[model samples]
Target chain A: MIKRNIFRRTILISLFIILFSASTFIGILDIKLIDLLKLDREAWHNFLYFRIPRSVSIVLASAGLAVAGIIMQAISQNKFISPTTSGTISATQLGMLVALLLFPMGSSFVKFGFAFISALIFSIFLMVILNKIKIKNIIYLPLIGMMYGSIISSITSVLAGMFGKLQTVQSWNVGSFTLLVKGRYELLYIIFIPVLLAYIYATKFSIVGMGEDFSKNLGINYKSVILLGLVLVSIISSLTYIIVGPLPFLGLIIPNIITLIYGDNLKKSMIDIIFLSAIYILICDILARTIRYPYEIPISFVAGVFGSLIFIIILFGRVKYGSK
Target chain B: MAQNKKLQTGIISLAIIVIICYMLIKLIGVRSLFALKMIVKVRFPKLLALTVSGVLVTSASLVFQSIVNNRILTPSMLGFDAIYIAIQTIIIFLLGSVNFLLNPIYNFILSTGLMIIVTLIMYRLVLQKSKNNVVILLLIGLILTTFLNNMVTFLQSIMSPDEYLNLSAGISISLTNMNLDLVLIALPIMITCIVLFYCDAKRLEIISLGEDNAINLGLSYNKEVIKHLIYIAISMAIATALVGPLSFLGLIVVNLTREIFKTNNYKILIIFSGLLAIIFLLLGITILEIVGHITTLPVIINLIGGIYLFYIVIKENKI
Candidate 1:
C-alpha cells in the first residue's frame, strides 16, 4: 500500500508541474520556455505582473471550489450536492448586488464583508431547510436548491434593473480570469484561510458525513463541525464569485470525479483533489485565452462546457457500472 | 357538483382578470376614436403574441409533466430555451447584427430548427443512454442549459457594446417588444401544436399512470413519449422563438391548475393551465407598466414562480 501510495503521489506531482508550466507559458503574448533563462525585462515584467497572478487565481479558485464541493457533499451526506447547485453562489451574488446598490463606492473589504455575511446566513438557512425536510430522492434536494437560486437571481435582476445597474450585474455574472491583473485579484487569496481550515477539519467532516447521530455517538460536536464546514464552503464560494463571477458545475464535477477515483476519505484524497482541480482549471484557462487569440473567452465558459461533459460521462458511467 | 363549481370559479376569475388586463393595456390613456384605433393596433399584436405564447408554453409544460409522470418538470428543463438562446447568440456572433435584425423570419426558422435538432440529439444520446431515467434526463438537460448559457455569455463578452445590448434585449422575454410578423407565423404553429396535444389528452392521462402501468395497459410507452416530446419540442420552440424563455411560468401555472381544479382530466387541466398562463402574463405586463421599469415579464413570473416551486418542493418533502 505504501509503495502504491508513493507512486500515485509522484504521478500527481508530475501532472501538477506539467499543467502549471503550460498555463503560465501560454497567453495572448507567448513566453517561450527559453525566454525564462534570458531574463529579459519585458518577459520578466509580464511574468511577474500578468501571467503569474492570473494562473495563481485560476488555481486558487478551482481548488477552492473543489474543496467547497467536497465539504458540501460531506455535510449533506449526498454525493451530488455542490456549492453551485446548493444555491450558495447565487445567494452570494444577491448579497453582492445589495452591497453594490447600498455602497456604490465602498471598498472591496466592505463589499466582501457584506457578501460573506449574507452567504453565511443564506447557507445556514439552506442547511436548516435541508434538515427539516425529509427528501426521499437525493435528486430533489439539488433541484429545490436550484429553484431557490433562480428565485434569488430573479430578485437580484429585478433590483438591478430598477437601479439601472443591469450592466454592472451582467459584467459580474460573466466569470473570466482575463480581468485578473496584479492588484485586481488579491481578494482570491481569501480562499487560503478557508482551505486550510478545511484541511484541518477534514476528519471531522468525514465523521459528519456518517450522519449526525453517528457523530454524536462518537463524541463529536456534530452541529458545530457541520456549521464550520458550511462556513468554509460559503467563504470559498462567495469569494470566488465576488472575484471571478460564477463558474457553474466546477464544484459539482471535480469533487465527484475525485471521489469516484480516490474514494471519499477527505484526508487521504484532499491533496489529489486540489491538484487535479488546479490541473483542470489550468487547462481550461489556457483554452479560454487561446481559443479566440487576442480576444479571450470567459473562463467559466470553458469550465462549464468541459465540466458538464465530464458530468454527463460520470453520471452515465455510474448507471452502467452500477456504482454508488 | 363541487368540481363543477370550482371549475366555474376558476374560469370566471380568469375571464375577469383577462378583461381587466385588456382594458388596462388598450384604453388606459386613449381619449378619442383615433387614439383608440392607434392604441388597439399596437396593443393587439402584443396581446396576441402574449396569448399564443402563454397557451403554447403552459400546455407544452402540462403535457410534458404528464408524459414524464413528474409534476416538477417543465419543457424549459429540457434545454429548449437554452438551445434557442444559443442559436440566437451564434447567429448574431457570426452573421452580424444587421443581417440577423433584418431577417427575422430566417432567424425564427433557424432558431426553431436548431432547437428541434438539439432536442432530438439529446433524446437519442443522453435520454436513451440513461434507459429513460427521467431524473438523469433532467440533470443532463440542466447541464446543457448551463453549457449553452456560458457559451452565450462568452460570445456576449467578445461582442461589441452595441451588439451586446441588442443581444441582451433580444434574449429577454418582453410582451411589448415582440416581432409582429414572427408572432403571426408562430400563432398558426402554436395553435396546431396545442390542438394535437388536446387530441392526445386521453393518452396523456394514461401515460401519467406511471410508465410500467401504461406499458402494462398496452400503451407503447416509449413510442408515445417520443411522440409527445416532439409535440412539446415544436410548441416550446415556437413559444421561445416568439418570446424569450420563461423558465418558471409553466411550473407555476400547471401546479396552480392542478391545485385549484383538483382533477386528473387533461382536458380541464390543459385549458385551465393555459388560461392561468395568459392571466399571469397579462398581470405581469400590467405590473411592469405600473412599475414603469424595463424589467421583462419573465422576471416577475420567475420571481413568484420560483418561490412557489421552492415552497411546493419543501412541502412535498415534509409529507
Candidate 2:
C-alpha cells in the first residue's frame, strides 16, 4: 500500500511539473529553454512580464475555484453544488455592475469588496433555501441553483442594458487568461488567504457535512464553522471572478473528480484537490490557446466543454456504481 | 362542476385580457386614419407573433412535462434554444452579413430541420440503453446545453464585431423586432404541429400514467414518445426561430394552466394553455411598452418564472 501510494504521488507530481512547464512556454511568443539559458533579453522580458504572470493567475484562479467548490460541497453536503451553478458568480457580476456604475474610477479593491459581499449574501440565501426544502432527488438541487443563477444573470443583463454597458459586462463574463499581465493580475493573490483558511477549517467542514446535529453532538460550534466555510467560499469565488471572469463548471467538476478518486476526507484530499485543479486548468488553458492558433478562445468555453463532458460521465458512473 | 366553473372563469378572464391588450396595441395613441392604418399593420403582426410563440412554447412545455412525469422540466431543458443559437451563429459565420441567409424563410427551414435531426439523435442515445431515467436525461440535456452554448461563444469570439453585434441583437426573444413575413410562415407551421400534438392527446394521457402502465395497456410507449418529441421539436424550432428563445415562458404558462384548470384532458389543457400564454405575452408586452421597452419580455418572464419555480420546488418538497 505504501509503495503504491508513493508511486501515485510521484506520477501526480511529475504530471504537474510537465503541464506547468508546457503551459508556461506555449504562447504566441516563442521562448525556448535555450533562449532562457543564453539569457536573451527579449525572451526574458516576455517570460518575466507576461508568461509567468499568466501561468500564475491561471493556477491561482483554478485552485481557488476548486477549493471553493470543495468547501461548498462539504458544507452543503451535496456533491454538485458550486459557485458557477449557484447564484454566487452572477451575484458577483451584478455587484461588479453596481461598482462600475457607482464608482467608475474605483480600484480593484472596491470592486472586490462589493463582489465579495454580494456573493456571500446570495450563497447564504441559497443555503437557507436548500436547507428548508427536503429534496428527494439530489439532482434538483443543482438544477434549482442553475435556474436561480439564470434569473440573477438576466437581472444583471437588464441593468447592463439600461446603462449601455451590456457589451462590457458580456466581455467581462467570458473567462479568459489572455488579459492577465504582471500588474493587472496581482489581485488573484488575494485568494491564497481564503484557501489557507479553508485548509484550517477542512475538518470542521467534514463534520458540518454530517449535519448540524452531528456537529453539535461533537461539541463543535456548528454555526460559526459553517459561516466561516461560506465566507471563505464566497471570498475565493468572488476574487477569482473579479480577476479571471467566471470559470464555468470548473468548481463543480474538479472537486467531484477529486472526491471520486481520493475519497471525501477533506483533510487528506485538500492537497490533491489543489494540485489536480492546477493541472486540469493548465491543460485546459493550453488547449484554449492552441485550438485556434494565434486567436485564443475563452478559457471558460474550453473549460465548459471539458467539464460538462466529465460531469456527464460522473453522473453515469454514479448511476452504475451507486445503484448496484 | 367546480373544475368546469374554474375553466370557464379562466377562459373568460383570458379573453378579457386579450381584448384589453388588443385595444392597447391598436388604439392607445392613434391620432388619425393614416396612423391607425400604420398601427394596425405593425401591431397585428406583432400580436400574431406573440400569440404564436406563446402557444408554441406553452404547448411544448405541457407535452414535455407530461411525458417526463416531472412538472419542473421544460422543453428548453432539451437545449433547443442552444441549437438555435448555434445554427444562427454558424450561418452568419460562414456566409457573412448576407440578408438572403438571414431571411425568416431560410432561417425557419434551417433551424427546424436541424433541431429535429439533432433531438432525434439525442433521444436515441438517451433512451436506447435503459428505461427512461429522467434524472439522467435531464443531466444530459443540461450538459448538452452548456456544451452548445460554449460552441456558440467560441464562434462569437472569432466573429467580427459587427457580425457579433447583429448576432447578439437577434439572440434574445423579442416581439418588438420580429420578422412579420416569418411570423406569417411560422404561424402555419406552429399550428400544424400543435394540431398533431392535440391529435395525440389520448396517447399522452396514457403515457402520463408511468411508462410501465402505458406499456401494459398495449401502447408502444417508445414509439409514442418519439412521435410526440418530433412534434415538439418542430413547433419549438419554429417558435424559437421566429422569436429567439424564451426559456421559461413555457414553464410559467403551463404551470399556471394546470393550476387554474386542474384537468388531465390534453385537449382542454392545450387550448387553455394557448390562451393563458397569449394573455401572459400580451400582458408582458403591454408592461414593456409602458416601461418604454427598456428590457425585453423573456428577461422579465424568466426572472418571475424562475422565482416561481424555486418557490414551487421548495413548497412541493416540504410536503
TM-scores, all models, native as reference: 0.94, 0.94
DockQ each: 0.60, 0.56
Task: Evaluate candidate 1 and give its CAPRI docking class based on DockQ.
Answer: medium
Residue-wise C-alpha lDDT for candidate 2, range A47-113, written one tens digit per residue? 9899999999988999999999998888888888888777788899998999999999999999999
Instruction: Report lDDT (Cα) of residue B134, candidate 2.
Output: 57
lDDT of each: 0.83, 0.83
Q: Which ten residues in a row have the lowest lDDT in candidate 1 chain B?
A: B19-28
Residue-level lDDT tens digits of model 1 in A32-149: 7677789877888888798899889988998999999999999999877888888787788888989998999997777788887888888888898888878666766777777677
Worst 10 residues of 2 chain A by lDDT: A315-324
lDDT of 2 by residue, B172-200 (tens): 77455567788888878877877887898
lDDT of 2: 0.83
lDDT of 1 by residue, B1-319 (tens): 6877777686769767775666556455667786667556776788788888889999988988887666776888878878888888898899888897788788888888888888888887866777766677777888887788888777777789888777877788745556788888888887888788889899999999989899999999988888888788888888888888888899999998898877899988888888888888877777777767668788888888877876886787641
